[model samples]
Target: MKITYLGTSAAEGFPAIFCNCKFCNEARALGGKNIRTRSQSLINDDMLIDFPQDTYHHFLTSNIEGDRIKHLLITHSHSDHLYPEDLVLRYGAFAHNMRQERLNIVAGGNAYDMLSKTEQHGITLLKISPFETIQLGDYRVTALPARHAIGTGALIYVIEGEKNILYAHDTGFLFDEVLEFIAEKRFSFDLISLDCTNVDIPISDEGNHMGLPNIRRLVCRLNEIGAVSASTRIVINHFSHNAAPFYDSLVEAVRSDGFIVSYDTMTIEV
Candidate 1:
C-alpha cells in the first residue's frame, strides 16, 4: 500500500488565510513542510480519503492524476473534509473526456446525503454504516464509529490489502462500541493515521478532536491490545495553528515520542 499525505492541516489550515500569528508567520516564511492545507490522503492512486477544498491545489502541487482515483472514502461532511462541489466538476459539460469513469463515493449517512444532493455525474454514492465491510476492487474497507458528531457520524476507516491501515482522525477518543468491534475483529494494523489537532494539550474539551496526551494514551492502549506491532507505523496529522507548537517544533516533539508527524505532500509506502 502506498499512502500519500496530500494535506495535513485542520479546517483553517496552518498559516490560516490572512492571519499574522507568530506560528502562522513562521510557517509562511519557512514554507516546505511548515506549510499545510486541509487534510486529505490518497492510497495507491486508487482510493482517496476526504476531499478537502484544497484538492485542486494538492493535485497541482503533487502532480497527481485525479482521474486515477476510483474510490473516495469520506469520514464526515465537514467542509474541510468533503467538498462535494468538486465532484460536480467531474460531471456533464464541465468534465472533459479525461475523466469518464463513474467514481465510487462511500461515506456514512450525512456524508451520503451531502454527496447525493449534488447535481453531478460520474459518481456512485454508497451510504455505509459502522462495522459494515465494503469491497472495492482489491481492497476491503470497514467503517468504524467516530465520536465526533451526531448528524454526520464521523468514521475511522480500516483499509486492508497487502497491508492494513487504520485511518482514524477528525475525531477524539475511541467509542466503547468501536473498541468492542475491534476486539472482535482481532485485526492488526500496519499503519495508523490519527488525529493530533491539539498537540500541546492534555485533553481536548471538544468531542470532535484529540490532543497529545489522549493520542499517547490511545497508542499505549493499542499496543496493550496487540493491535499494533513493533513495525507498525503511527502518524499524527490534522493540526490546528492554535496548537501552540510550530510545525518543526511539533514534528520534533512527536518524533521524539516515536510518532511520525505528517506534513503536506508526505508519502509513505507499506
Candidate 2:
C-alpha cells in the first residue's frame, strides 16, 4: 500500500496561521519542508485518513480527485482531523464527474454526529468501536482506543492488507488494553505513523501528546509487544509550532532514531 502525507502539522500547522513564536518564525522563513498544513493523509488515492480543514489545499496541491476517495477513516472529531461541512462537495451539483458510489465514512460516534449534519449525498456513515475489526472493501480495519481525548473517544487505526499499516495519531501513550489487543492479533505493522505533537518536550505518557524522547520509549514498547520490527517504516508527524527545535533541527535530532519526519506531499510505499 502507498500512503501519502497530505498534511503533517498539528492543530495550528507548522508555522501556524498567526503564530509569531521563534519556531514558527523559523519555519516560515525556512519554507519548503518546514512549511506544513494540518494533519491528513491519503492511501493509494482511494482511501483517506482524517479530513482536515486543509482538504481543499491537499486536493489542489496533491492533484488528487476528491471524488475518487472511496473510504474515509476519521481518528477523532478534532477540528484538525474532521471538517464534515467540506464533504458537501461530494453531493451532486456541487461536484461534476463524481462516481455514483457512496463514500464510506468509518468513524466513532462523535464523528458520525458531525458528518450527519452535512447535506452531502454520496455518503454512508459507518460507526466503529475500539478493538472491533471490520471489513471495508478488501481491507480489515481495527479501531484501537487512543490515550488522548477520553471524553471524545479518539482512536488509532490499523489497516490490514497485503502490507499492513498502523495509523496512530492524536494520541499520547498506548493504553494497556490497546497494547493487549494488538498483541492478541499478532500483527506486525509494515508502516507506523505516530503523533509527535509534543516534539522535544519532556512529557511522556502523562500528556495527551508525545515528544521525541517519549516516542523512543513508545516505539520500544511497541517492539517488545511485537507490533513493530526493525524493518517497519516509522514516521513521526502532527507537529505543533509550540514544540521545540523547529523542523530541520528536530529532523536531525530524531533521524538517528530511525523515524522519518513527515512533510506535506510526502509519499511512502509499504
Candidate 3:
C-alpha cells in the first residue's frame, strides 16, 4: 500500500492561520516542509482519511486525484477532519463527470448529523462503530476508539491490506481496549502514523493529545503487545507550530529515535 500524507498540521495548521509568534515566523521564513496545512491522508490514491477544509488545496498540490477517491474514512466531526460543506460540491452543477462515481464515506455516529446532507448528494454512507470492521475493496478497515474528546465519536483506524497500516491521529495514547483488540486479531502494522500535536511538550499521561514522551511510552507498550516489530515503520505527524518548533531541528531530533517526521506531500510505501 502506498500511503501519502496530503497535509500534516494540527487543527489550526502549522504557522496557524493568524499568528505572529516566533515559531510561526520561523516556519514562514524556512518555507518548504515547515509550512503545513490541516491533516489529511490518502491510501493508494483511493481511500481517503479525513477531509479537511484544505482538501481542495491538497488535491491541487499533491498527485492525488479527487474524483478517483472511492472510500473516505472520517475520524470525527471536527471541521479540520470532516468538512461536509465541500461534499455538497460533489454533485449538481458544482462538479462534472460523476455519472459513475460512488464515494463511500464511513464515519462514526458523531458525524452523522453533520453529514446528513452529503448522504443525499450521491455519496454512499457507511456508518461504522468502534471495533466494527468494514471491507473497502481489498482492504479490511477496523475502527478503533480514540483517546481524545469524550463524546465526539473520535476514532483511530487500522487498515489491513497487502501491507497493514495504523492511521492513529487526533488522539493521544492508544487505549488498552484497542491494544487488546489488535493483539486478539494479531494485526501487525507495517506503517503507523501517530498523532504528534504536542510535539515538544512532554506529557506523562495527558488524555487529549500526545507529545514525544507519550509517543515513546506508547511505542514501548506496543512493543510489549507485539503490535510493532523492528522492521515496522514509525512516523510522527499532525504537528502544530504552537508546539513543534522548526522543521530542521525537529527532523534531527526525531530521526535518531527511528521516527520519520512527516511533511506535506510526503508518501510512504508499505
Candidate 4:
C-alpha cells in the first residue's frame, strides 16, 4: 500500500493563518516541509483519512484526481479532520462524475452525526465503532478509540491489507481499552503514524497530545507488548506550531530515535 501525507500540521497549521509568533515567522521564512497545513492522508489514492479544509490544496498540489477517491475514513468531528461542508461538492449537481462509484464515508457516532447532515448524492455513510472491522475494497479497517477531546469519540484507525498501517493521530497516549485490544489481537503494524503535537514539551501525562517523551514511553510499551519490532517503521506526524524546535532541528532530534517525521506531500510505500 502507498501512503501519502496530504498535510502534517495540527488544527491551526504550522505558520498558522493568523499567528505572528517567532515559530510561525520562521516557518514562513524557511518554507518547505516547514510550511504545513492541517493533517490528512490518502491511502492508495482511493482511500482517504480525514477531510481537512486543505483537501483542495492537496489535490491541486499533489496532482491527485480528487474525484477518484472512493472511500473516506474520518477520525473525529474536529473541523480539521472532518470538514463536511466541502463534501457537498461531490453531489451530482456539482461534480460531473456519475460514472464513478459512490464514496463511502466511515466514521464514529459523533463524526457521523455531522457528515450525515450533508446533502448526499453519490455518497454512503457507515457509522463505525471501536473494535468493529469494516471491509472496503481490498482493505480491512478497524477504528480504535482515541483519548482526545473527552467524549468526542475520537478515533484512530488500523488498516490491514498488503501492509498493515496503524494511523494514530490526535491522541496523546493509547487508552487501556485500546492497548488491551491490541494485546489480545497481537497485531503488528508495518507502519504506525503517531501524534507528535507537543514535540518539545519534556514530560507530563498530558491527556490530549504527545511529545517526544510520551512517544518514547509509547514505543517502549508497544515493544513490551510485542506489537512493534525493529522492522516496524514508526512515523511521527501531526505537529503543532507550539512545538519549539524548527523543522530541521526537530527532524535531527527524532530521526535517530527511529522515527520518520512526515511532511506535506510526502509519500511512502509499504
Candidate 5:
C-alpha cells in the first residue's frame, strides 16, 4: 500500500493565514516541508482520508488525478477536514467522467448530515459506526471513535491490505474502548500515522490533540503489546501553529526520540 501525506497542519495551517509568530515567520522563509496545509491523506491514489479546503491545492502540488479517487473517508465535519461543499464540484454539471464510476464517502453521523443536505452526484454516503468494519475494494476499514468535539466523532481507520495501517489522528489519546479493541486484536500494523498536534505543549492528559508525552506513552504501549513490528513505522503529523517547537525543531525532537515526523507531500510505501 502507498500512502501520501497531502497536508499535515492543524486548522489554521502553518505560517497561518495571519499573525507574525516566530514559528510562522520561520516556516514562511523555510518553505517546502515547513509549509503545511490543512490535514489530509491519499491511500494508493484510490482512497482519500479527508477532503480539506486545500483539496485543489493538494492536487495541483502533488499532480494527483482527483477523478481516479474511488473512496473518500471523512474523519469528521471540521472545516479543516471535511469540505463538503467541494463535493459539489464532483456533481454532474460541474464534473465530467464522474458519471458511471461510484465514489463511496464514509463518514460519521455529523459528516453524513452535512453531505446529505448537499446535492448528490455519483457519490455514495456510508455512515460509519464505531467498530463497524466496511470493505472498500481490497481494504477493510474499521472506524473507531475519536474523542473530539461533541456530536462530531472523528475516526481512526484500521486499513488492511498488503500492509496493515492504523490511520489515527485529528484527536488526542486513544479512547479506552479503542485501546481494548486493539489489545484484543491479533493484527499488527506496518504503519501508524498519529496525531502530534501539540508536540511541544505539555498537558496532563491528551484532550483534543496529542502532545509529545502522550505520543511517547502511546508508542511505548503499542510496542509493549507487540502491535508494532521492529520495522513498523510510526509517523506523527497534524501540527498546530501554536505548537511551541515549530517544524524543524519538532522534527528534531521526534527524531531524537526515534520517530518519523510527517511533512506535506511525504510519501511512504508499506
Candidate 6:
C-alpha cells in the first residue's frame, strides 16, 4: 500500500487562517515542514481519504488528477474534511474529458445531506454506517464511529487491500464500542494514522479531539486488543498550530515512540 500525506494540519491549518500568532509567524519564517494545509490523504494514488477545502492546492502539488480519483471517503460533514461544493465541480462545465465511470462517495450522517446536494453526473453517493464494510474500488472500507462531531455522528475508516490502514483523524480517544468491534473482527492494521489535533495538551477520552498522551493510551489499548503490534507503523497526523508549536519539536517529541510526524507530501509504503 502506498500512502501520501497530502496535507497534515487541523481545521485551521498549522499556521492557521486569519491568525498572526507566534507559531504562525514561526511557520511563515520556517517555510518548510512547518507549513501545513488541512488534513487529507491519498492512498495508492487511486482513492482519497477526506477531501478538505485544500484539495485544489493539494492535487496540484501532489501531482494528483481529480478526474482519476475513483473513490472518496469522507470522515464527516466538517467543511475542512468534506468540501461539498468542489465535489460538484467534478462534472458539467467545471470539468470535462473526465473518466467515464462515476466517483463513488462514501459517508454517513449529516455529511450525507451535504453530499446529497451534489448528486450530479459522474458522482455516486453511498451512505455507510458504523461496522458496515463495503468494497470501495480496490479496498474494503469499514466505517467506525468517531467521538468528534456528535451532531454529525462522524466516522473514522479502515481501508484494507494488500495492506490495511486505519485512518483516524479529527477523532478523540478510541471509543469502547469501536475498539470492541475491531477486536471482535480481529482486524489488524499495517498502518494506523491517528489524530494529534491537540498534541501535548491534556485532554480526556471524551473530548472532541485528542492529544499525544491520549493517543499513546489509545495505542496501548489497541495493542492490548491485538489490533496493533511491534510491526505496525504509527503516524501522528492532523496537527493544530496551537498544539504543535514547532515542526522540529513535534518530530522530536514522537521520535522516541517511532511515530511518523506527517508532513505535506510525505509518502510511505507498506
Task: Tell me each candidate's TM-score.
Answer: 0.95, 0.96, 0.96, 0.97, 0.95, 0.97
Pairs that clash in candidate 2: none
Best-performing candidate as measured by TM-score: 6
lDDT of 5: 0.85
Estimate, for each residue in 1-270, the C-alpha lDDT of model 4 and write its tens digit: 899999999998989889899999998999997899988999998999999999999999999887788889999999889898888888656788554559899999689888888888778899999899999989999999897877888999999989999999889789878888988988898999999988977546557988888888998888888888899989899988888436678789987797988889999998
**Model 6: worst 10 consecutive residues (lDDT sum):** 84-93
lDDT of 1 by residue, 1-270 (tens): 889999999899989877789989888888888888999999998889999899999999989888778999999989889998888788557666755387888999788888878885778888899899999889999999887875577788999999999999788988777767776799799999989988876665446788888888888788777788789999999988888546678877877677888988999998
Alpha-carbon local distance difference test for all models: 0.86, 0.86, 0.87, 0.87, 0.85, 0.89
Model 2 C-alpha lDDT per residue in residues 163-215, reported as the tens digit of each score: 99999988988888888888888989999999898887677586788888878
Cα lDDT tens digits for candidate 3, 1-270: 899999899889878899888889878888998999999999987899999999999999995567788889999888889888888888779778964388888999688667875546768888899999999988899999998786888998999989999999889888888889999998888999999888878755657778888888888888888999998999999887788556677788888688988989999998
For candidate 1, give the lDDT of residue 53: 98
Score candidate 6 by TM-score against the native. 0.97
Give the root-mean-square deviation of each candidate in angstroms: 1.5, 1.3, 1.3, 1.3, 1.5, 1.1
Error of 1 at 209 (Å): 0.9
Total clashing residue pairs per candidate? 0, 0, 0, 0, 0, 0
Q: Give the per-residue Cα lDDT of candidate 3 at 99.
A: 44
On lDDT, the stronger of 1 and 4 is 4
Q: Tell me the tens digit of each residue's lDDT in model 6 across 115-226.
A: 8877567888899998899997679999999999887869999999999999997799888999999999999999999999999888899999998899999999999999
